[model samples]
Target: MRAVIFRLMGVIVLMLVGAGLVGWWFGPLPAALVACAVALVVIGVDTAAQLRVLAWLKWPRHDNIPTARGVWAEMLYRAARQLRLWETRVAHEEDKLKRFIEALQASPNGVILMDASDQIDWCNDTAAAHFGLDPKRDLRQHAVHLIRNPEFFAYMGAKRFDEPLLMRRNGSYGPLLLSVQIIPYGEGEKLLLSRDVTQVERTEAMRRDFVANVSHEIKTPLTVIAGFVESLRALEFSIEERDHILGLMQEQSDRMRHLVDDLLTLAHLEGDPHQPAEERMDMRQMVERLAADARALSAGRHRIKASADAGGLRGARTELTSAFSNLVSNAVRYTPPGGEVRITWRVLHPDYGDPYAEFSVSDTGIGIAPEHIPRLTERFYRVDRGRSRESGGTGLGLAIVKHALLRHQSELRISSQPGLGSTFSVRFPLARLDLAKPGQAAGAPDAPRADRESISA
Candidate 1:
């Protein structure tokens, strides 16, 4: 500003000197006064132009900024240079904010922001799903009011967020756990986070059940063995009594062995990531062999029959045998005396669909209840625990069947109705089934009326 004043002073001085020199050569007083007035007008115009530049700084834009001469033009250039620097900084900040929002959107966990009044400020898509809330529609709604879970409301009211809240994903449904936490942040604001913990809780429950079941199963046999050993040591017994006890002990030992073997099979199936070996297996011979085993297991108490229409399947031969044998053996064991257990294998294809194969085991026994049918394939799941145990079942047959079928990219489907009997079937994928083979080209043309019974299983 001082430099500007000095420059103005120099201009005034030069104007005076020129005017004085002209006036000295012509009319002295009047000419000098006129030149001094002109200099004052020039100074006023320059000051006004500077004022316009200062006004432009308040809400700066390029189009409205006036053209200027001399020092005023220099001031405008400087102002424009500073504005560009500020624009770059602002652009960088905006870009960073955009990236931050994208990162939150991509996060697997749900995140929500709330204001001091507990009103929703912003939320990601995951938060929307976790809370069953719409991101745009629910903005500014009260967090507690919107979530509406009693526990969630209590959590908000208590202002105690050290521990997270756990609730079911479907509040009306069975336990499918969700974890929610609130973190207090700046100026009474909070950050709410939620995660789906259903699988974790499921695993924990299964672990507890597995441990309890294993302990009980092992302890039953151990107790029987121990009791007999104690009897032999602590008291004298007759030869017949001793033999009876020994036989009972051996039966318990066999039961324990079967349980251990099933458990090991499950462990092996779960641990091995590689696919089962592929080998072509003829369904006819396989069914016959397994049917023979079923009859032996049944001890002629229940009638057993089997028919095969499928040519072959491609999978591990041993795995297929184990799975099929389990199904057949289960049917025989579960059937009452004089009841019939039937097994069938046939190729299935729609008019326009690729060919696949299905194997089913059906038994005319005490049919499973509708409720129990869904859980039949679960390990140790039973329609009647006493009946399952009495039938000499380890309760792992269906589970093994399920796992084996899964390895073949298939599923065990069960259909049952009380007093009507149950059917368990596995539908193999086209990739695992061989629709054509040398033998058994003619499908089950002479199949029984019951064999043709159509049910989902």
Candidate 2:
């Protein structure tokens, strides 16, 4: 301010000096006129500088500011500095907002933002897919109008956001379950969040079924044993009759024991996280042992045969044997009298993939229907509950097989048709298989023809 005042005073002094010189040359009236004219010229120049500042203000660009002198120059320099600072702050804020949006997009759960009027302001990609919404096309659209789930629509209208709502939707594979919740935020705005709980819900349901099945399975045998004990204590019977009653009790006890063992096996399979031991397994010897066990169980009721063209495998011997034995036992149990149960181990060289060893059990039993094939490996699941019980199965055989095979990085494939036959096959990767020498095969003289049922699991 002081500099501006000094500069103005200097200009006035210069004008006065010129006016004095003119006065010295001419008269007092002429000198006064010259002073007025000089003042007008100064005003004109100042006005033009002000207009230049105004023009720059109309379309301000940091790199292209109009040059000026005196007070306007100082003002323009300060204005340009402030503008650059503001631009930097704005760019920083924009970058932060972009990063925040990207984090939401990468999130597994779904997120949505809505306005006070219940219109969708924004939603992440997961949220859009969860609700079948288009992020851009559905902007500002009513939330209820887009998501057609009755429970969800009512949930928004009620504004009772304390508890999350479990919503079921039909997915391409099966039913999908979502846990959705809304939270009140700024003013009347709301944040809708959703999580896919399909696996969680299924696991919970399976737990319930497992508990019920275990209780029932145990109770039936306990009731039988209790009845037999009461009969022996109260009723008078001959030695033969008593022996018979005691034998029945022992059978029930054995059944309960077997069930307990199977339950323990399944628990171990699920709990253990270690990979199957990388020990070489003699496939020839294993196949022979399985065939022997199946024949003993069959007791002349079924024709049992075994074949092996592979030498050995590299996995936990116990786990591999248990998994292979389950399939063979299941085949023997399900086949009727004179029916054939054939087990084989052969190398499979696919046209497009690496060679693997396949161990298959083909049985001419009352094969499973297509509907029940998928659930065959589920614990205690049965297509014919009565028949399954009569066969003296613990019902956890296939479930154990599934976990064991999975631990070995192997897969089980099932192909079966109702009444004709069923084939349960296990394919071990080349990494775990030891190929046999050419023409060196064990067990049955000739391999049984492969069964090609329509359904596979």
Off by over 4 Å in 2: 170-175, 349-352, 436-457
Error of 2 at 379 (Å): 1.1
Model 2: lowest-lDDT 10 consecutive positions: 448-457
Candidate 1 runs further than 4 Å off: 1-17, 26-28, 31-35, 63-65, 132-134, 137-142, 145-150, 167-176, 436-457
Best by TM-score: 2
Per-residue lDDT of candidate 2, residues 1-457 (tens digit) = 8768987897799789878989999978888988888888888988998999998888888989988888888999998998899899999999999999999999999999999998999999999888889999999999999989999888887889999999998765677898998999999999999999999988999999999999999999999999988888899999999999989888899999999999998999999877655776677677888888998999989888887764668888888888888899889888889899988888777899898889999999989899999998999998898888888888899999999999988899999998988999998898887654335453325333342111121
User: Which residue pairs in candidate 2 collide?
Assistant: none
lDDT by residue (tens digit), candidate 1, 73-100: 8889889888889999999999999999
TM-score per candidate, chains pooled: 0.86, 0.88
| lDDT for residue 340 in candidate 1, whole number 0-100 | 91
What are the RMSDs of all candidates, in order? 5.0, 5.4
Return the clash pairs for model 1, or none.
Answer: none
